[model samples]
Target: MNGDLNERSTGRQRVLVIDDEPAIRETLDTFLSWEGYEVATAESGEAAVKQAKEEQFDLAITDLRMPGMAGDETVAALKRLHPNLPVIVVTGYASDEAAMRCSKEGAIRIVRKPVQLEDLLSLVKAALG
Candidate 1:
């Protein structure tokens, strides 16, 4: 929700969750929110881009594949909007090529799907603080 996005100045670092699946979006949003970070969700890379332009996020966790504007493209686009915005690519298929592509596109890390909450939290903390 926009409320979380708007509360950036309150000291709760913002995080963007991008994935096409409603369940994935909700899971990450709830988990991150519970972890005390302001969380925002996007159903597609396009929507994520729109939010990136309008708001600020300390990091983004995005699915590698989606209906439109795949994760790699999304990473590049987001970097253009916020050159230093850290991104973590989440993919079901973490092939070498895909991992390299994501790295090349400026992603800070690539996390395979069915994400482990604790590990993700570690990455999030390392990235944000």
Candidate 2:
């Protein structure tokens, strides 16, 4: 499984939220937190993978274009670390190539930016299920 902290204390599904924007990260964190899920934020793909090394997460929400690793690469890496991990790619720009790459790399769904909490919550629920 996720190795360290695989069985979390809260019994809540731990979610890893990765984005370059602090506002988006904080917003998702707050919203998901309020919805009773344990959330972790990472500013880059590298950071997200590093955190994933130390902790297990039920789901991951990542931005498509980041300063360091791209979202598709992040999805590939995260999938390597945890094959069963469900990933959601959220981006302001979603081209056809982006969508294909995300799917090929193992993302379960792609949510465009200006993320709606309700839609995201529904996706998250379906993913964690």
Candidate 3:
């Protein structure tokens, strides 16, 4: 009934993408799918949390800023629900303060936006491993 259910039936690793921008979410969903991952997308952190609670995801890639809950809150919620879940935060600009906070908040990686496919894939692989 749910999108994640379809992905699970395929026996693929599931990834949850949380971003406010439609283009970015679609692009990452397509790219991650091409890279052999089962992808689900949320337009805001609130939606992300809802989806995360409904389904199990191996990883979550979320934007630093969004309309409702920010990336930090999203990561916190995800960690609370799925303690072992790996989260990657993507921001438009590099911020030392944010990076430090996210690190302490349990983010596995903080990546800059306009992410290169290769670098993102490598990070994903490393985190998933």
Best by TM-score: 2
Model 2: how far residue 118 lies from native, Å: 0.5
Report lDDT (Cα) of residue 65, candidate 1. 94
Error of 2 at 122 (Å): 0.5
The digit string of per-residue lDDT tens for model 2 on 1-129 reads 345546487889999999999999999999999999999999999999999888889999999999989999999999999999999999999999998999999999998878889999999999988
Model 3, range 3-116, lDDT digits (tens) per residue? 557547878899999999999999999999999999999999899999988889999999988887988888899899999999999999658987877778789999987899
Give candidate 3 misplaced runs (Cα > 4 Å). 1-7
Clashing pairs in 2: none
- Model 3 — which ten-residue stretch has the worst lDDT? 1-10
TM per candidate: 0.93, 0.95, 0.91
For lDDT, the strongest prediction is 2
- Clashes per candidate (backbone, < 3 Å): 0, 0, 0
- Name the candidate, 2 or 3, with the larger lDDT value: 2
Model 3 pairs in collision: none
